[model samples]
Target: MQSELILKKDVDLHHSQDPYRVQNADEIDEDQSIERQLRFVLNRLTPENFQKLVINLINLPLNTQERLNTAVNIIYQNALNEELYSHLYAQACKLMSQIKVPFEHVSSKFISFLSILLKKCEKEFDTDYHKDKYYEYLVKEAEFVTDEQKRKQLLDQANEQLEKAKQNYIGNVSFLAELYNMDLLDDAILHEGIKRLFEKQEKDEENLECLCKLLTRVGPKFDNYKNKEKIDDYFEHLRDIYEKRFSISARIRFMILNLIELRENNWTPRHESGPKRIEEIRNQVLAEREERELRFAQTVPQTQIEFMVADGRRYSLFYGYAHHILDQLKYREDFDRVLGYILKVDPDRHSELFEALICISMDKSDQQRDLIGEFFYQNLKSKVFKLDQFKMGLRKVLLKALESYMKGYKFPKKLSQILANLIRLDFLDISFLKDAFEPVKRDQLCARIMAKTLKLAAEQIGCQNVSDIFELSGLDFNYFFENFENEVDRRDFFKEMRIEWVSTIHEHQRQSVELIQSFKEKLEVIFRETGEEPLAVLDRIEPEFHKEETKTKEFIRALSVVFFEKVLHHKRIDSDKFKKMENILVNFVKEHLDLQLEMLYSVQVLAFHMKYETNFLPVSFMLLYSDEIVERKAFFKWMNNPRGKGHGIAQVFLSSFFEHISRPQTEK
Candidate 1:
């Protein structure tokens, strides 16, 4: 009775137009057997319902080989009928094999069924070949007999059968590839099938089409397998066929050439959408990012999403609304409302928000720049923003200013004004100037713009304070001086701006002199009170010179002068103390540039105190020369045009110093 039911359903499936269509209620109620249930589940398979279908199939009563055979037959027949769901069918077969119970041998069964199905398809291909020949003969005979209607009918039947045969062949090849992709079939089976098609293609163009279709479906996978040499040989054969087969249709020839190129590119199609194409795109993106980083040295790639979650809602404040508000900001009075809106939207990205505000204000009017400056000052003063955050924002702003300058924009006077305002507010200092300008030196235009901005800033804050800032910051004036090729432009610029470069130097010199005097007075007092060694006295008063580089150099020169005086007056020297002080001076000169002139001045001071006692000058000169404390070239250059020629002892000391250096060490 069960066999009869199965036979009845098979007949129904064979006759139905849409074999896998959902059965009606009357048809479904006729059978509740395991075979019927399997048929029902297989017909309804989908990606979303795949797991549920797997569970449903497992729950069916397939406790015997006979029932399992029936279920496998149903799955195979459904897959053959509906060719588009071949991958899903393959996946179902894999899942059933993993069950390890009654379905453990299900894979072997499916493979055997697939083998039989492939043979059946090949037999159909042969049958179609014979039918086409028969039709060709009938058409020719009818044409010879002048039967136009019969010839037309024969041609239509031939075309219809050929198309149907082509679709069935494509579907069969696709199913084989799908099973291979699911690892349910061996490479040997696939290789044999390809070999058979290649041989048949030598005679039949339809076979050639089938061969190309089969290869296109599974070529990349098969080439990547252990049979790469064999695949390569096959492609070589395909190339020869493509070149020599003149009777091949244009369409088939193009397919053959494309397949050859695809294999040559490691199975990566150039214009196709696949994993290899996606990977190539990803690599190109990374390379572009690296180039951008190299071009814009000051900018870093930011990957995090600029959004914040608040009250169960997402607000992309940095990218969307915050920038709009900041850009539209005009008057100072609107600062509070804008700030309120920004804080409400997202406060976590305040640094980025502030940076965006500074960048926007760069191209704005003077009034808007002033508004931003005032906005920053108020927030800074109210302690609503951290100093480090402000510094970070300003650093990024300087980079933006540089980018604008590179594009031939004029120097940003408004940005300079903002910086001056911050300096006056004591919220920013000169050290920030060094930090901001140091990284941009590789770009000369950006460096020059920075110098011009600082010059304009000096205009706002007054030259005296600017001079003091430069002196305290220890920023290299060469950054400013090198901007001009000749001295006249520098002098004219300074004169027109009432920025007395000479006076700034003199003022710093005068400050250094006063500072030296204070140190001398402190040393005298300490020595008088404790009768301590002069080195010990100096050590007690050694300030935190690390805070400033200029002061540190001045302190070292002061120590040199004081020690030389002590050595002259006492008619003796403390070797340990003198060596310690010399080490300090030598290390400082080594670490700094443009200090050779200063060391020369210190040597002159020692000479003046010594007067005609030239014996001690030789040791100091040799130490300076031998240790390379002062550069040797600068030392010789300075000796020829010695300073302080008004003093009689100056000429005498320099003459003797030259003789001492020119003489050999043994003679000394």
Candidate 2:
């Protein structure tokens, strides 16, 4: 079965193998290129024609002919798939010693097959040729990987290579570009690369482009970056070098991203340049969307409405641009616009979509975020027809918000406080009391809601576990202060509100009640003498003694810190006008000595010193600190009585204070 190997005008087989061939396979003579020659054989891939091509490839001598080498490369690239290329690579390896073709050009032809060897080469890249090829193949294949760990491993190895190259790396741009494109969790390599990028004195456009790509990948993953401080520092560096390095388009895009990073950090763009470029980015990005105004009108736009609603059709476009809309809405708190957007969107959309969007948009750790969510919940109770539909969105948003807490996310202290206020203000519904998700948060929420109701009277608002005012015998000055306005109610309201809080034989309760009444009586006279409001307009934030606004009435108000420790912790009533008030205190006790009113005033004095939280000497000439007046022993003895907590707590507090004040002022 020997066929004559006639030279084909279209195909180029070596004359020895060319000596035997089939007739129809050798027809075309127009093309001269080697790639075209191989493509011709690609067209006639019958079993017999395939046999001839393989036999020729096996029999032909490997030589330095560029045309022949190129034809092999083309065949490898065009017809030899990864499997066949792998099979043929053994032969190519043998032929490489004899052929003069550039290996990179030929190696690239079987790139997918060649990539399998890169991991081995990267591990022991002792030779320059192997290191170069390892980087070459890694750059080509990195785009196809999506596994976080695998990508991380590859980046770690590549960064190691870059480290070996030190400050002057020719392939740095290529290696960094590939690393930038990969999605991974380990940020070590990335953080290091970005640091070195800024540290280098001179940078070209390529370096700048690579940096932008890295930043874009890192920007949205704000929740994932454990070290938020580094993220902030990176943005600060970017802002500093922006005008000098980045182009106008790059600046626009970067500033917009920077603003988002700011929002995630519970902040807004602080710099003037940030705001200006944000305006430019807003206009430019929106203008591009505006180009398709007719398409949006033709049918509902496919674009998802998000924090930035730029199209003007579906989105209200808060502040007329999408630039800093998210953070601005957060800062200004335009809840109506948020509600309006929800109302205007497709009524048929699943409610969770809007719910997730609104919740994720907020910095849940920020207290201000609670106020916005509170606004949504409070408005849900309205009788208005328009607000009725918001029930689902409102409910879903709250559940989603609570779900975060269930996942072990802690609310900030401020947020925890605001939650109590909102719940107390009737901002939540009771039906959610049964969501068995986070019992702790549920109990906390319910406890707060009930506390507002139990605040006035001693009855349980709804929950049995929540404390009732009656249980504490109305000895709670806080509850009594807000609820029992008159002295009779102070003395008598507990028996009427909840009898369980009362004990007829508890004489300790009797004297404590008497003290509270006496303090209130004295406080009223002090209030009258000082007038209702102070005439002086002192800066409320400054320490009372440091203030220059000295008015007689204001000094008395300053003195109110005694009973209202929680209210006026820092106030000092040391003005000359307060001397008359001290005389009143001395004379009042003289008048009420038969009633034994001295203990009540001593207890009141202890309350003020307690507010400072320091064990140091009291800063003002307050009564409790005066050693000449031995009221400390009296207060300690009264605390031992059943009216207050006994167990040497008063002795411990005074001892701690005296010990602290005894130290050197500098040490204290």
- Best candidate (score: lDDT): 1
Compared with the true structure, what per-residue lDDT tens digits does model 1 show for residues 533-604? 545554555552343643454655665566565544354444445654565455446645456656666766
- Model 2 lDDT tens row, 1-668: 22445443356646685476654635743334344545565454432233234433433333324444554454433322322223233333232322332245553132222232222222322233224655556655665789878877777776665454432232333233332333312467567666765564243333444455446434545324485788778666666666464543565446546655665655533553323434345545655664465345446554543333433543323222222233334422366665565454455552444344444434332333444445544554453213323435435544544556532333323233322322321212323222321233333333232233343222212221122112222223233233334656544644433432333323432444544445455545545555433332122222333334222223333334332332232453333444323433342233332222233434434432343244322333234334222243344444334233211223334544544433444664
Pairs that collide, model 2: 5-18, 5-19, 5-20
Which 10 consecutive residues of model 2 have the lowest summed lDDT? Answer: 460-469
**Predicted model with the maximum TM-score:** 1
Q: How many residue pairs collide in each prediction?
A: 0, 3
Local accuracy by lDDT, each model: 0.59, 0.39
* Candidate 2 Cα misplacement greater than 4 A, ranges: 1-199, 202-311, 315-371, 374-511, 515-576, 583-668
